[model samples]
Target: MQWRGRRQSSNVEDRRGGGGMFGGSGRMGGPMRIPVRGAGGGLGITGIIILLIAAWIFGINPLELLSGGGSLGGGGGQTQSRTVDTKASDEMTQFVSTVLAETEDTWNGIFQAEGQTYKEPRMVLFSRQVQSACGTASSASGPFYCPNDQRVYLDTTFFQQLDQQFGASGDFAQAYVIAHEVGHHVQNLTGILPRFNQMRQSMSPEEANRMSVRVELQADCFAGVWAHFTDQKGLLESGDVEEALNAATQIGDDTLQKRSQGYVVPDSFNHGTSAQRRTWFQRGVQNGRLSDCDTFNNPV
Candidate 1:
């Protein structure tokens, strides 16, 4: 986690001062929409009927799609605005830039080895709410990667929440979060995410959730792979790997459900269980091989 003095990524875009065009009220009214690639226009009556039929067949709540709530499976809602600490915020920005640069180095080399060009994604730093190609999202949505725009969106305060609320502190844990989203960028480039998005349209909610767990776990593994290479570069400090694993555990769908609702619903799990997440991440750390990070073909 010795990130200071490291090269910072120039791909970062700062959009913190101004509120998004959607406003900074953080109140989400109107119809909810999940930002899927190639998604546009209003749903016609026939489209609604199809969605209803799909929900009926898939055993999912039709309202989730209609209301635009849990269709994509990440938390998002109103978040209160807080005063920013200028010094700390700037430092965190530097830290994030350094981590992103490191990821670029790791993935660039890996892609080159495979004779493919790695397209580095831009990172958007926002406060309160931000607009993405996928749509507008609040800080409560946490850090996310928009396949539509191929950019990683982050609210640096999430790092504070990860430490205080989730009990997953340490710079490495923060790095893991950034790396996981960047991993999605890699998946998007490799056609994995595009294919998944296409196939999920026909899949039931349960099926989609099952597939999502694999996708998320694969990202965790990719983060681990980044860690492995980072460690090789002598950047990892003692307890760094453990910090990343602990972050993975804290954010596992099962763990989050248990913490929020005091119960676990396996069918609704899209991010895998804590053990599954840890196992996949460990696999990546141990092997650092893309072949070993296959979660779809292998049991996760």
Candidate 2:
């Protein structure tokens, strides 16, 4: 949580205040504003830094971001606008840069130790919705990683939402969110995502959702793996591990369902239960072994 004066990552593609290409970010509770990095004109930064800290960022469609629904309602055009305040804007940008630098250091070392190349994913900061190789997403969609471009898209205010709405506060919790996206990138590197997507071709919706659950849960585990190395390198502080576990518990598909939908549909859960999330995260924290995160072979 003590992040200040650290080197920020240069790979960040800031799109916070660009052309009026997107709309304001909205959620069930209320409308939220986020600090953005300016984008020249493209799907570079993340517009959806909040339905979650998972897979929603990149694969979501553009219409979904603008219209606030799947229909798109016929006015499907891109807009360009700028929305950013100087003071808050500065802080958010700095914080993300520092966090990204940490991720780069940890992941690079991890890949190096394995005799593999560590490709760092660019982090895009955007306001509202932005375009991506994956698709267009609204800030309401939450932070997500785009495997197609190898970048992480985030709406900075989601950090506020994580604390207020999801009850997952603290700096380490935020880092866990980013780490989870990075985890998806890790899965891509290992061919897990492509293989899983391939399996979805012949799968029933329920079965495919099950596979997606495994994929997401393993992402949680991979995030935990990052925490393990971070701790060893003195980047983790006291109570940091618990903060991550708290975050893992907060965003569990079951927990979110109960909070938002008033019921739990086990069949539709993609991110796993809170207990499952915590256990797998702890698995990587303890072992720090990539092999230990074999969620596919194990039962959910």
Error of 1 at 247 (Å): 0.3
Tell me the tens digit of each residue's lDDT in model 1 across 27-106: 21111111111111113343244345444534566665454342332224323344333345578888998999999999
Every model's TM-score: 0.78, 0.76
Q: Rate the local accuracy (lDDT) of all candidates.
A: 0.72, 0.65
The per-candidate count of clashes, in order, stands at 0, 21
Number of the top-ranking candidate, with lDDT as the measure: 1
User: For candidate 2, what is the TM-score?
Assistant: 0.76
Across residues 1-300, which tens digit of lDDT does each residue of candidate 2 receive? Answer: 666777777777767654234443221111111111110001112212211122242344433333233211111222332323323558778777788888788778766654556667777788777766555678767887665556677878888888898788788988888888888766655444544554566778788768777777888887888888878877778888898899888877778877876888888776678898899889889967766676766666
Point out where model 1 deviates above 4 Å: 21-89
